[model samples]
Target chain A: MTWQPELDELRAREAEARKLGGADKIARQHAGGRLTVRERIEGVVDPGSFHEVGAIAGQAEYAPDGTLKRLTPSNCVMGRAQVDGRPVVVVGDDFTVRGGSADATIREKPIMAERMAHDLRLPIIRIIEGSGGGGSVKTIETTGRANLPGGVGGTQLYHYTGANLSVVPVVGLGLGSVAGLGAARLAASHYSVMTKETSAMFVAGPPVVKRLGEDLTKQELGGWEIQTKAGAVDHAVESEAEAFDCARRFLSYLPASVHALPPVTTPTDDPARREEKLFTHIPRDRRRVYQMRPIINAVVDQGSFFEMGRMFGRSIITGLARLNGKPVALMASDPFFYGGSWTADACAKIIRFVDLAETFHLPVVYLQDCPGFMVGLAAEKAATIRLGVRAMAAVNQTTVPWCTMIIRNAFGVAGVVHQPANRYSPRYAWLSARWGSLPLEGGIEAAYAADMAEAEDPAAKLAEIEERLNRLRSPFRTAEAFWVEEIIDPRDTRRLLCEFADLAWPLLTPAPSGLRMRP
Target chain B: MAESPITIRAEIGASVWKILATPGAAVGEEEPILILESMKMEIPVVAPHDGVVVEILVAEGQQVEEGQAVATFRR
Candidate 1:
């Protein structure tokens, strides 16, 4: 009369599900230098904090007497887990189970994970691998039907997957050969990472691609090097443990969802501290390039800057950092690349980054040194100006509090778009700052071309004109006319930036940014 | 481990301004191998690792395209 026998049977089924694809398949997975889905979940989340939702929802074979004979668990292992003690919906592809193909999947489980993240207002972290519930040719034989795409999950799965972008922070990690839906899932995220040795992401794997006349290995087809360099993924890590650490660190700055402001940590570094190097960081000779990262590190909370999309956009650097323990979006110019002129790829990066900032309600701080949109035929072919205008629109439309520090060059339309017009945005400039429609070196030749051509000594006239403009070009003259904002000593940058962060903290709201984010 | 020859390429199209490292010269990671002038700014092309420069493929005042090999080294 006791229900203990049924309880025992339930426990047995749960244990059977935990075995994943069994010992031999799991061994093969291990031999490939990749962790199983369960191991990945354990490595990423708090120890023993995983609360699984569906442990035994899979195909089960029945005995002749109506007793359960075998249970093959679903390939999608999803549950709620604590990352840095914050609850998140973690969905991982169990690649050991039939390469995590559609034949081995229970689509509802992944759909439920997405719904949980969206409804609960929690972050979603996808530990992606294999085909990510995408179909296999064997599925046609198994079902005896060629199923239409988006039919199995009823489109709600795709809806929630895309909807989660505006509602919560989504992080995708490519831990192995992620194809089809897995690639889409990885690309559609606030942040994404892939392992250098183990991960490859593409719409399809090599076998299908080979029929298109391109024979290549998975690594050659869609390796981390190819994706990260192309900006298809944000980061490429050396190991799974490093990827987990990156995920934890990235989440540490943001709130659980867009319904909350970013988490503020207790300040460890002194806000008033100023580095002496800032004074001499920019060379007096404006033609020489300098490292912008060191300046960023010195101004933000020490070691808090997390850079993204480093390989794709060489001119503009985008990242997140803390100012006096308050998280903020950071944009700076890397003068080493095209003299910090915005390229087509850099412009695209800007749009995505500004959208992320607006979505999360994080205030933005730009260290400006833009010369202009890139020129030359390559730039035209890539539609740099068109993308640049879109970048300008993205910046102009943001409602977040903004602060701009003109460290050096700020010329042309690209330079003027540093902050939105008709807003109470605070702008600071260093003594070395320079701003104009164009630099004197290039402007004089263009503007005074007729005057120079008419002169007996054109070269001398050009130099004389340049010298006269150069004398008037001192940033003090601009400050005197109030054309530029306050020009302060470089050593005071961190102090002023910290003050801006303190001011911006109160202005941030937990409401969603009404505009749709472009992933 | 045996050192292999690694080619360092120009990241942007620019005229070579200064050759900072010569063949057989030892350099550290991120140490400038040369400087290229573009858009009125001097951009540095740096060593990929601690290595000895095997050759300088581009000369001063020469215009090099992006992705063109500028130097080679063995780490």
Candidate 2:
């Protein structure tokens, strides 16, 4: 191919367009421990594959003397690219120019990116930083009037987030201070991530909060720790690279958009491979706590568990794991915290995780060791019952294949709720299943009061009652009644779950028509 | 012959306020090892049996009924 003059001219134009803020601004952005908007897009997409849209479209200013005053285009960038060869549309906020304020959000920038993704059936990754299309104070000054709510280009951002929940996978990366509409953008995505040191998300920054008479640092208001632990953001990473990597990993388990099924990879582990360690993972002493993470790792693929909302619900762990190379939603009770008692916060987390799994057509794998719901004045005040019922309802409504393994301590009504309803109940198994109305320690004293009082030594009499009840509470008693399907050895969990994965694989061939929106 | 032990029903029916001992907090027979509050009054939950506290069923601020075992001791 010969180098034509028009082709060379166009190349120069593209280079000029990229140098929007000049070299000084670009270097300053690098010096401040931040990536330029274009650099971030490059970091997320496969190298040299991004085909940018609307590069030449920007604002043109004229002076009173009929000469050019300044040239400023849209303070946002939009393009199409591939992540690991999977096509996706990307939108980034150019913060170096006008702080990416809403006034500079050109009409076609958001619409082009959103509509293209929607029409082309591709996932959209939005690299949002700064105000991210929110109206700034200077905008009102420049326009000589306040922009009406939902006015021109007002609902564009809303439509972008709304489409993600319904038709496509939207991932938001919080790389800087995300406030107002920016924070909403971060939350509205299916998966969101933030850099621990550099990113913060809040309804309003410290300036607005300070004016309201409360002094707070930006980190105190909405740092990565606060957001991730509060369930505002799904994951937090130590670096921007890790945040991007997290987003890529999350999308791997989900479809490019809502209309497709998640891609399946070949299984590397044998379906019948069993790890004997699970048999003794739970301690014989009920009061002692054991680490639940290892049990989760042992059951899933050797190194395939990717946890979400980990810190928020300390009592429950939710994540994505591959069983025989098939993606499954993994939920487990963390016995270390509050004795694995589900609290109001933990209930909310369960509901959210279940909804996501059901909507995405992912089968659920529950490693249950729940003692039941947390009870107290604090629980009641927090409306634990209402939240608990909602969690139960979410689990009940899910149509996906579910498999529950009772590791230990399935007691009380909350424990019963872990199993699905009788008709569409999941394939249930018990590994040392121990179920009852309550633990015997508390029940023995009340039931045997008369017998204890009549004995010569009341204290000694109570001990005899406890000893008898302990014998009755054994898992062998429950197994004799056939209450649980089978009491397999702990090491058999991996093999059993892999078998369930094979059984459930036939169900994933067809996409469900009515995909529930994640709650 | 043994005298009948008094049945100590909770004066305030509520969840556990706080469990003061593990399975083995040395407690005098009449000493309060746990506290339960219901309505508005702070109800002192006392040791029903004297010995080494063998098992504490509930943790701090756990819910308990009028006659729930907050702890068990070997006399």
DockQ of each model vs. true complex: 0.86, 0.03
Scoring only chain A, what TM-score does candidate 2 earn? 0.92
| Residues A1-519, model 1: lDDT tens digits | 899998999999999898998999999999999999999999999999999989898889999999998888999999999988899989999988889886787878889999999989999999999885447878888889887878755677778767888988999999999998889889999899999998999999899999999999999999997898789999999999999998888888888888899999999899999899999999988888899999999999999999988888889999999999999999999999999999999999999999999999899999999998888788999999899999999999899999999989898999988998659899999888888898787789899989988999998999999889889988898888989769999899999999999999999889888778867
Query: Which candidate has the highest DockQ of all?
Result: 1
| Model 2 TM-score, all chains together | 0.82
Question: Total clashing residue pairs per candidate?
Answer: 0, 9
**Candidate 1 Cα misplacement greater than 4 A, ranges:** B61-65
lDDT, candidates in the order shown? 0.90, 0.76
Top TM-score: which candidate number?
1
Local error of candidate 2 at residue A415 (angstroms): 1.4
Candidate 1: the clashing residue pairs are none
RMSD of 2: 10.2
